[model samples]
Structure formats: structure tokens, C-alpha cells
Target: MNDDMRRLVRVQEIMVVIDALQEKIASNPAEVARLEKDLLAAQKDADADRARVSELSKDRRRLEMDLMGIESKISKYQSQLLEVKTNKEYQAMLHEIETCKTERAALDEKILLEMEESEKRSAALRSMEEMLERKRRETSQGKTRLDAEAQDLMRQVGALESERTEIMAGIAPAYLQPFIKVARQRKGLALVAVRDERCGGCHVRVMPKLIQQVRRATGLIACDSCKRFLYVPDEPSRAAGAGAESPAQ
Candidate 1:
């Protein structure tokens, strides 16, 4: 390749790197968002579990208070039975005492059930909290790693931009403009090699005359199909040069 071709190739190489780096930088935010969303879900689940445990605790406490009140009432009724003036009143007080005892027993059973449920909920809450903490740590680490990677990619892009500028400075404006225009349209490939009578950029066959012009490298030789500037490799050109003195078969 001649000097211009070399410069163009260098520019394309730098652009490819720059494009990749820019794409990574653009995608960094989405990655961070996904991590944050995962962490948020974990936190919400932990909070819900904790709330359930709290509610069960309140129920257990209320049941305990109710049992204490029922016991006090039963004691009062039994003491009143001792002072009853007739068997009927004594029987009525006895019935009231039995009802209070039954209510206390029910409260005891309810308290036991509440305690069992609270235990289960507490265990679940602990598990959720641990999971949430792990998720938080993972999210934080992921964010840090992603941010560092994005910063590094940005730095690489900056360096590539500097290199591209220097390479572009060596080429004439007329040649550089067309390459830039085509590269923008073709995704960073402005020049292509002509191989096997085909345009490398579009993979379309080229005319014999176009291939000969590319071989000479005497002027800009664009592929008729893809409009990409075509060049023949230096090895083949040199080989052709070496055999130029041989008589044509």
C-alpha cells in the first residue's frame, strides 16, 4: 500500500476502536440500571418479610394481654361464688367462671399459634435480610466495576481520536472527505481490497479495468458497485512488478 492507503487504513483502524469504545460507554447506564433494579427487588422483599414478622408480634402481644385480663375476671368470679347467698346465684357465678376459663384457654391456643407463625416469619425475614445484603454488595461491586470499565473505554476513545486526527492530517482533504463520507455510510469501512476480481467491501465482482487501476495505484480506484476506494495488496503488486520484464505468454 502507498502512503495514502496506509493512512486511510490507520484511520479506519482507529475508528473501529473508537466505535467499539463508544458503544460500551453508551451501554454502561443500562447495565447499571439493571443492577439497581435487582437490588431494589431484594430490598422490597426483605422489608415485606420484616413487616409480616412485626404484625405477628403485635398479635401475640395482644393475645397475651387478653389472657391476663381473662384470668383476672375468672379470679373475681370465683371469689364472688364464696359469698353467694343462694345456690342459684352460686351456680350463676360458677357458670361465669367457666366461661372466663374457656376464653383464657382459647387465648392460650391462639397465643401458641401466633408464636409459631411469628417464628416462621422471623426466620424468613432473616433469610430475606441476608439475601438483600448480598444483593446490595453485588450491586455496589458491579456498579464500581462497570464505571471503571466505562471510564477506561472513554480514555481509549480519547486516545483513538488523537491518533485518528494525526493520521487524517497526512491525507489530502479531497481523499479524506470521500473516505469519511463513505465510512459514515458504511460503518467505518471506507477502503476495501480487490481480491479475485471482487470488491471486498461489497463482495461484488469488479471489471477487469477497475482491477488493473487498483493494481497500478496511480489514482483513486473506487469499486463501481460499492463505491469504496479499492486497493491491491502490496505483495501482488510487487510480484507483478518483478515479472514485468518477462515476455507476455
Candidate 2:
């Protein structure tokens, strides 16, 4: 590679590094945001579980109160049975006791069902709480690591920027503009190597004359198709020994 090509390649190397660091820095915030969202979602789930258990507990309390009221009514009816003056009165009092007892049994059954649901809800809430704690710890750790990584990437970007400035100064003004323009347009790729007699940038077959020019590094030769500058390495020519005896296979 010529001095200009070498310098441009160096600049490209630095730009690639800088671009990667910038991307990582840019993406770190998004990752942190995602982690925060995940943590929030877990907290919401835990809160819902706790709310469910709280509602079930309230229902259980209401059922117990109803059961107590029914019991009190049944006891009063039983006490009135001793003072009943007629068979009809006694029968009516006994029927009232039986009705209260039935209601009490139904309330007891409902209370039991509510208790079961409360127990399940409580267990689920506990599990969710544990999960929430774990998620919180994980999110915290992830943010810490991401922050550290972002800091390191910024440092690397600073160093690469300095190196890029030096390499840019080494390139000639005539060659620098095209490199910068193409690099800007092509996502930091201004030069490409010719391989198999094809343009590496667009993979189009290069004309023989242009290929020879690129190999000689006579001047910056742009690809016919992609218009990107071409390069050739210092490796031996593929056809240098084609007419000689073939090596033993």
C-alpha cells in the first residue's frame, strides 16, 4: 500500500473503533431503560399479588362477621324456646333457629373458601416478592456494569479520536477528501481490497486495466461500479508462477 493508502487505512481503523465505542455508549442508556422497565413490571406484578391477597382477606373478614351475626340470632331463638306458650309459637321459634343455623353453615362454607383463596394468594404474593427482589438486584448489577462499560468506551473513543487526527494529518489533501466523503457515505468504509479480480466493495468484476492500475498503486482507482477507492496488498501475484511447473499435490 502507498503512504496515502496506508494513512487512509489507519484512519479507517480508528474510525471503526470510534464508531463502535459511540454505538456502545449510545446503546447503554437504552439497555438501562429496558432493565428499569423490567424491574418496574416485576414490582407491578408483586403489587397485584399483594392486592389480591388483601381483597381475599377482606372477604374472609366479612364472611366471619356474617357467621357471627347468624350465630347470635340462633342463640336468641334457642333462649326463646324455653318461654314458648303454644305449640305454634314453639314450632315457629324452632324453625327460626333452624333457618339461622342453615345460614350460619353457608357462611362458614364461604369463609372456608375465602380462606383457601387467601392462602393461595398469600403464597403467590410471597413468590412474587422474592422474584421482585431478585429482579431488583439483577437490574442494579446490570446498570452498574453498563455504566462502567460506557465509561471505558468513552475513554477508548477519546484515544481513537486522537489517533485518527494524527493519521488524518498524514494523508494528502487530494486523497483525504475522497476518503472522508466515501467514508461518510459508506459507513466508515472508504477503501476496499481487490480480490479474485473483483471489487470488494460491490463484488463487481473489475476491468483488467483498472485492476492492473490498482495493483500497481499508481493512483487512487475507484471501482467502476461502486466508485469506492481500491487497494491491493503486497502479496505475491496470483499469476506470477502460473507457467512454471505445478507444485506436487
Candidate 3:
């Protein structure tokens, strides 16, 4: 390849690398978002557990208060038993006392159950909080690593872009303009090597005459099918005469 062709190849190479780096850089935000989303989900779960623990605590307090009221009623009923005058009145007072004890026993059972559940839920909440803390730490570390990686990629792209600019300056407009136009049209692929008498970009058969012209390296020559500039490899065997066919238009 001539100097212009070599520069074009190098520029394409640099641009391809730059494109890949920029793509990775672009994806950094989405990766960060995904990490944050996971952390947020864990936080939400921890919050729900805390709310449940609070609710259980409230229920336990309410049950304890109800139990206290029942105990007071039982004490009042016992004191009234001493004031009864007749045996029939005494029996009625005893019945009231027995009814109060039954209600008190039921309340005690409910309070016990509530306290047990509260203990269990509180334990679960503690465990969830520990997990949330760990997740937060991991998310922070991951974000930092991604940020560092994106910054590194940006620096590499900046360097490659500078190299591409220098290479572009060395190339004349006649060659540079076509390369730019074709690279834009073909996603940064404006030049390809001829292999097996085929256009490397399109894989279409290349005319023998055009292959000869590409081997001569006289001027910029594009593939008829894909419009990408073609070149022959710097090998003696491959650069041998293709045929004496008429030159391509």
C-alpha cells in the first residue's frame, strides 16, 4: 500500500477502536443504574421489615394494656364478693368472678403470642438490616470501579482520536474525502483488501482489470459493488498479474 493508503488503514483502525471504547463508555451509566436499582430494592425490603416490626410492637402494647384492664376488673369483682349478704347473692358474685378470670386467661394467651411474634420479627429485621448494609457497601464499590473504568476508556479514546486527527492531516483531500464519505456510509469501514479476486467488503467478485489497478497502487480505486477502496496485500505472490482483461470503468 502507498503512504495515503497506509494512513487510511491506520485511521480506520484507530476509529474502530475509538468506536468500541466509546460504546463501553456509553454503557457505563446503564450499568451504574442497574447496580443502584439492586441496592434500592434491598433498601425497600429492609424498610418493609422495619415497618412490620413497628406494627408488631404496637400490637403487643395494645394487648398488654387490654390485659391490665382485665386484671383490674377481676380485682374489683373479688372485693365486691366480700360485701355480699345472702348466699344467692354470694353465688352470683362468684359467677362474675369466674367469668372475669376466663376473659383474663384469653387475654394472657393473646399477649404471649404477640410477644413471641414480635421477637421473631425483630430478629428477622436485624438480619435484613445487616444484609442491606453489606449490599450498600458492595454497590458503592461497584460504582467506583465502573467510574474508574469509564474514565480510563475516555482517556484511551481521547488519545486515539488525537492520533486519527494527525493521520487525517497527512492525507490529501482527494483520498481523505472519499474515505470519510465511505466510512460514514459503511460504519467506519472504507477500505478493504482484495482476496481471491473478491471485494473484501461485499465479497462480490472483483474484475481482473480492477484487481490489476489496485495492485499497481496508481490512484484510489473502489469496489464496484460496495464502493470501498480496495488494495492488494504487500506480498509478491499475490501482487502477480491477475489477467489481461479490459480495465474496469
Ranked by lDDT, the better of candidates 1 and 3 is 3
Residue 107 lDDT in candidate 2: 87
lDDT of 1 by residue, 1-249 (tens): 556665777688788888888988999999999999999888888888888888989888898989999988988888888899999998899899889988988999999999988998888888888888889999999999999999889888888899889778878777788888988888888898878888888999999987876766655678888888997755744445432332221
The C-alpha TM-scores of every prediction are 0.90, 0.85, 0.91
Clashing pairs in 1: none
Q: What is the C-alpha lDDT of each candidate?
A: 0.82, 0.83, 0.87
How many clashes does the backbone of model 2 have?
A: 0
Instruction: For candidate 3, write residues 126-235 as lDDT tens digits.
Output: 99999999999999999999999999999999999998898799887988998999999999999999999999899999999999888777689999999999987655
Residue 217 of model 2: what lDDT?
A: 69
lDDT for model 2: 0.83
Q: Model 1 RMSD to the real structure?
A: 4.6
Ten-residue stretch with the least lDDT total in model 1: 240-249
The best candidate in terms of lDDT: 3
State the lDDT of candidate 2 residue by residue for 156-228, as single tens digits. Answer: 8988898789778877888899888988899888898888898888999999888778767656889989989
